[model samples]
Target: MPTDTQILAAIDAAFGDSPRPEHFTHYRHCCECAEHDELLRHRDRETLQHADVGNAGWDPICFCSPEGIAYYFPALARFALAEPVPELDWYGWQMVFHLDYGGAENPFFQHCAPQQRQAVAGLLAHLLETRTGLLEMDADSALRAHGVWAG
Candidate 1:
């Protein structure tokens, strides 16, 4: 099997970009990293097709995708076992999101009201456009640095 670093380089090359040496991760499998940008780009069809565009089926558990569903139930149950919500940071949220965790179980997802789906979508679009890189290097950081939160 290829080492994680090799996988990252291959992913970066596929995107026509050099490997970002500065993107060292706090966790081994960092979420929303630059490498993921290219990976997701390759799966544009699946991502676009499964995107929660209409928000009509936004359940409290948010187990829409079987992939997301797997993580969702387990995470929710774990939190229930522990009691109280966990205070996850931006990167943490991205990890869960990218890991297929969704629905009301996600603290970030719970923050978005049903009517605010469009706003959430808008922010998501901006994040992808800006390339958060799952760290302080991307557009989200630039926006946060400039005191701009909402999209």
Candidate 2:
């Protein structure tokens, strides 16, 4: 099993060159919401790194643009792994691992490049190895369904 440090490093290497969107917006055109406004306020990756996932009263995972989604993924993963916040855990799991519950597409997989998708596969593998009981479904089936298990 890979350590958190290793998983994070993989995430960084995969996403390092992701382009920042010129004008960030929601995945859909929705009425102005706090989460959307908050995301727009942060222009740089470093600033978004400091964003509090809980501040918007919701996860804001699906509502973000592809660029913003990728940009925020690392921070969200870090919080989910390192911190004991259940909301982050649930939302993070939903965003990355749960395929049947949310949007028709896995936003991370759909928005990310091939390498980025591989990195996410790594992240899921790490989670399965380390946090055995957290995932709700048949783990192997879920991994297989997503085709995230490289092995």
- The best candidate by TM-score is 2
In candidate 1, what are the lDDT values of residues 2-102, reduced to their tens digit? 33334333323322221222222222343433343333333322243222111223322232332222223223222212222334323323322432232
Where model 1 places Cα greater than 4 Å from the true spot, the runs are 1-100, 103-112, 132-151
Judged by lDDT against the true structure, how good is candidate 2?
0.58
lDDT (10s digit) by residue, model 2, range 32-137: 4444645655545565542344443454544566677676667655654664464343433553433323333655456777787778678777766765566555
Worst-scoring 10-residue span by lDDT in model 1: 18-27
Q: What is the lDDT, from 0 to 100, of the residue 148 in candidate 1? A: 20
Model 2: residue 54 alpha-carbon error in angstroms: 4.2
Error of 2 at 20 (Å): 1.9
